[model samples]
Target chain A: MLNRVLHRRTSALVCSALTAALTGCGGGVDVIGYDVTIQQTSQCTVTGAAARNCEDPAVLGQTSLAARWFLETADDGVSVTVTTHEGRTIPGLLFDNNTNVINTEGCAGEGGRCVFVRRRYQTSDVNTGCSTFGELIFVGHFPPDAPQRLVGRFSDVAGNTEECGTPTINEVVFSVNGAKVEQPAQSLEGARP
Target chain B: MNRPLPMSPVLVGLAIGFAGCAGDGIDFFEVVRSRVDECAIRSNGEFCVEPEQFDPPTVEVWAVETRAEVALLYVDEEVWVLDPLPGDADPATVERTATKTSVVIDGLTGCRTDAVREVGFLSVVTRSAFGTTGTLDGSLSVRSVLTGPESCGSTPVGERTVDVVSGTVSGP
Candidate 1:
């Protein structure tokens, strides 16, 4: 049913499998209806409060590349979001909320790609209160070289005359159900696009 | 110019004693500290006088992975020096010190909890005595807000300072 053979940072992949399986389409395909082939090329960690804790493979969309689950691309790169049903974590609060912007376009490199990053952004799967991660939504304004650590200089936070630079990208590759990612993302689950 | 004074057995013995001060009967780091003083006379880069006798304490090290690569960070020693004021009688006069501390890095190694960030504050070398020594109970202050695709949709994660305290290095 749940092909747990996916890649690094356990949380995101497990969630992806869970999210996909909830629809009842068992046997190796994801909820959005894509064939599954787990690739071992990945690195990820769970961030608790600070310093991105270790072991949650699906924590960051860039590094872990677990964004394939909630990623909602409307036939074009014109808009991007990850949402769930309930849409609000608290009563009268926005759960499927694309409310917080984590970063802004500053100099050149930062604006490289994936413009306008946001966190706790809810776009699909509005089912409320599923588990610990149910309320948390993640998004990344990614550049081609998405996977990374320490984007800006750590010293910059010290407010010194130092400016942080994006670290070198190690790897970034997207795939859809055993096939490479293509525009219009091959009709979710072969039926519900 | 002061002319050389005639030397006797007692003077020779004393000279031998002074030169031998760096040999033993003192902190091995003192030997290293002296080497630093001697090297600074010719260069500006940091020169640690790791004495031959110095029992280097072990250090804890760690690493982090970025998308395409892995960055390693570790605990190490930081050194500081107090320079002599300008126009002083002796311009070369100065004091040196060391502190064992930790900070975020691409990668790091060669430090341990048992080791001290031995802060050495060396005053002008007096003929009658060696320099003084001081230490802060072991402590460490390091932090970073790593922004990447690891946390949430290209957001910053673990962006905070960590304060660690140990014996001898009180931490800052």
Candidate 2:
């Protein structure tokens, strides 16, 4: 009975130590999915497109969804892609390792990794659209040695053009806990010829 | 003391013929000048002169799979890559070939910014083709921002739009 109690205590101590190490390093935990929150701080209007402090609770919410996070590393740079099950994809958030900074922001100062985020949304008119491009700072150590996980946050004003009807400008914050997966095959159906 | 001599019609005709030949020769030289020469003559931007001043200035054109074509302009140490605009295509496949034009100075300090593609103001004048020698012409207004600690102290550095105008990329 004493031997059994000692064995149980050792196992519990080891588990606790492992948990502390993982949490302290800000990594090594494979989360099920990402929790994303997007808030539009500016009231979007076509008439007078000016930045005014407006908050809509309907636009501010959180969702947990299944996503596929892919990381491609080259000698020159590293790029990440997050594709959700709903077919909403954020592609090519590139972090050029060759240069120590991305989008004029120092990655080394922020713990040696950064990704430049540039996303565009357009209307069917082709001429009507808005672009959001800025720096996405890594929360913990990025480009993990195993290439399995990524955690980052972004909170900045996205600039947009006037032709986008109203500024579809928004502030996005996301935390991704990605797992390693094979490169998805490109589908030819509905592809532009 | 000398009376005006009557000019021979044949001599006058020969003079006119020689002038016409000289004019034709000038036109031929103008038409046959290489694209590099044309770029030198027409461009007044820093990109035009720096490439020539540096050693091993070369302009290379290659395709990015089936998405778009790319042009690389390399001087002694500085390099600039031209990123063309993707038209009605999947942006994911052509992200590198898309509108983010980048430049690396001294092979150390670098900056990448999206080209301000207004309707008529900023556009690629000529896009280089794959496997064939071509010329690249356009004006790009890139945000003057540098990356890395090596670039933090670089001169003329600020967060402003720097206009690189009348740039031409052609073979050495």
Candidate 3:
């Protein structure tokens, strides 16, 4: 009876040890997921200007315009924020980067500024030809609570050129990619006591 | 898959290691416990080492300087747009659209060298205008010198003005 009892106990302990390992090897918990998009629309009134194949090198003009950005995450532990940038000396495209029309007096300057907030990171792995165009930022967080998300508006510009004057109107489009959140399927193996 | 087994490969091996040694009066259960401790130390509660899952690193914010230029010339009614080049060590060539003209700079470069900027931008600003009467007078000029006193190389990094009609170029 003593030997039988001892054998039973050893077998149980062996099983427990193996089970613990299988669980660990399955896969660690997911940490973060990211999605982002950018869009712009421009319209200009051409006086004598006629467009050619307009492939490139050719100059084009636009009047008023709007631009926006959308950034998001799947895990609430992850946070997101955005900041704008413009050229102070050269020229930037954060919208009206070179034009000043708030007071109608117009901006008489040649330079500008830009900034980004928090620890930034790109959450998605999507290949955008313009990777440096925008940036991403994020680390990890806890509790495994709710999902996370963020949406932001960028800028607007009205033609400020004294020569041709700003364009009449234009349409712009931007995208904020999704986190492609995965819902882990319930496995009956773990449910088995 | 991990259900307890009355006789498993591990159990058989353990039993065989010291099978007949029980005749020497060694406690079988105690020997089994000792063997298990050795195996546990080697495997860390499992039968193998698990690989770690990893993701990309995050970055903190810092001051970023930017510059841009736009020229709406009256001569041929052409527009030129240009913006500041990103300052990174591992450089890359990029094409940025100004207004109507797409400015692709083959070498828009900059770096922190000897406490100064060793960088420049090159691009075909405006397309050649075809007008018999227009003069090469109207040009695009935008400048915000973010470099030290000795800037723009020997050429000077100031107003990046391009002769929009002449198809000639200048930069910061």
Candidate 4:
């Protein structure tokens, strides 16, 4: 009876080990069925000559916005996309194992592993072909193994020039936090009864 | 001529005055002429070619002792400052020497090119008596590699060469 009990205990330990290995140990939690939650926290700031205030609704539309995130993993890197309910989408942001040394800007210090892209908006009429727009910088950090959650910041900086008129040099920053919402639909479709 | 036309003092004075005024008008017009028109840019890659982009670029040349500094202000708030040229470097003798300069291109994407290899010629063609006003006429082949934010994708990085074939600069 004692030997049978020992065997049962060993089997239980082995199952537990396998579960831990599959689900990941420590902070690595399975996010297959969890919905992503993104809240515009108060840790945001803005600076520059024409920088808009963080509290300004025109900056980010609404203080609280509903959004969904998706992730695609490949051999090269992981591509992350965050889409807001209002249809604003920040897409095609890729992060790989090699730390990007260029354009660290706000993504420095602990948030070193990052990928960012700057998009310009509003072409200046007075400056003719010159563009006088706010630079929208989207920076995010997603570790290779933990593609479930993303932590990063967004910055909007206005280009300043006399010929481009007095532009509002807005440098508002926003924090983004999200997790995987659900497993791929194909996976469920392929499941056998 | 009919026994040498006799000139009245008043008529002669008025004629002299009109001649002086005409000369002054010519000088004023010369000074007011647009200095930007004398500059032209040719690029193998992208940027700095469109007329609407840098149509009337600001050109300045400053004479400092034995050297001269030239600055060209282009679109997107970009500036190309060429410096340390021999003061006596005229159009004829400028081609024999080369000057190293740096350029900062701040467009939709910010880029910087350092250690720019400037070949060809750049000469200060004319200068006013006070040395405050002048013009430049010459050409320069600028070659360098721009390094910028990686997040800018592949748009703002790589090798670029801009040839300022013929340009005139106004100095302070």
Greater TM-score among 1 and 4 belongs to 4
lDDT (tens digit, per residue) of candidate 1 on B6-111:
2343354344334433311211111111111111111223233334643444433211111101111112221121121234344123322222222222111211
Point out the worst 10-residue segment of candidate 2 chain A by lDDT: A184-193
lDDT of 2 by residue, B1-172 (tens): 3333233433443443343332111000001111221112111222233334433323333221211122222222222232333465432333221122222232223332111111011212223365232222323232333333444454333332222222233332
Q: Between candidates 1 and 3, which one is better according to DockQ?
A: 3
Model 1 deviation from native, Cα RMSD in Å = 30.2
**Which stretches of model 3 miss by more than 4 angstroms?**
A1-24, A31-193, B1-172
Pairs clashing in candidate 4?
A: A50-A169
Supply candidate 2's per-residue lDDT for B68: 13
Q: What is the lDDT of residue A72 in candidate 2?
A: 28
lDDT of 3 at A3: 65
lDDT of 4 by residue, A75-150 (tens): 3444444333222334455544344544454344443245555556676565354456666656666545576566
How much lDDT does each candidate structure score?
Answer: 0.25, 0.32, 0.24, 0.39
Interface RMSD of each: 32.5, 36.2, 25.0, 42.3
Q: After superposition, how far is residue A186 of candidate 3 from its true place, in Å?
A: 23
Looking at candidate 1 chain B, the ten consecutive residues that score lowest on lDDT are B63-72
Candidate 4: segments with Cα more than 4 A from true spot: A1-62, A71-93, A97-114, A126-131, A143-146, A158-165, A183-193, B1-172
Query: For this target, which candidate reaches the highest TM-score against the unseen true structure?
Result: 4
Residue A102 lDDT, candidate 2, scale 0-100: 46
What TM-score goes with each of the models?
0.17, 0.27, 0.16, 0.30
Q: Report, for all candidates in order, the number of backbone clashes.
A: 63, 0, 31, 1
**Ten residues in a row with the worst lDDT in model 4 chain B?**
B23-32
Poorly placed runs, candidate 1 (over 4 Å):
A1-193, B1-10, B13-135, B148-152, B159-161, B164-172
lDDT of 2 at A103: 37
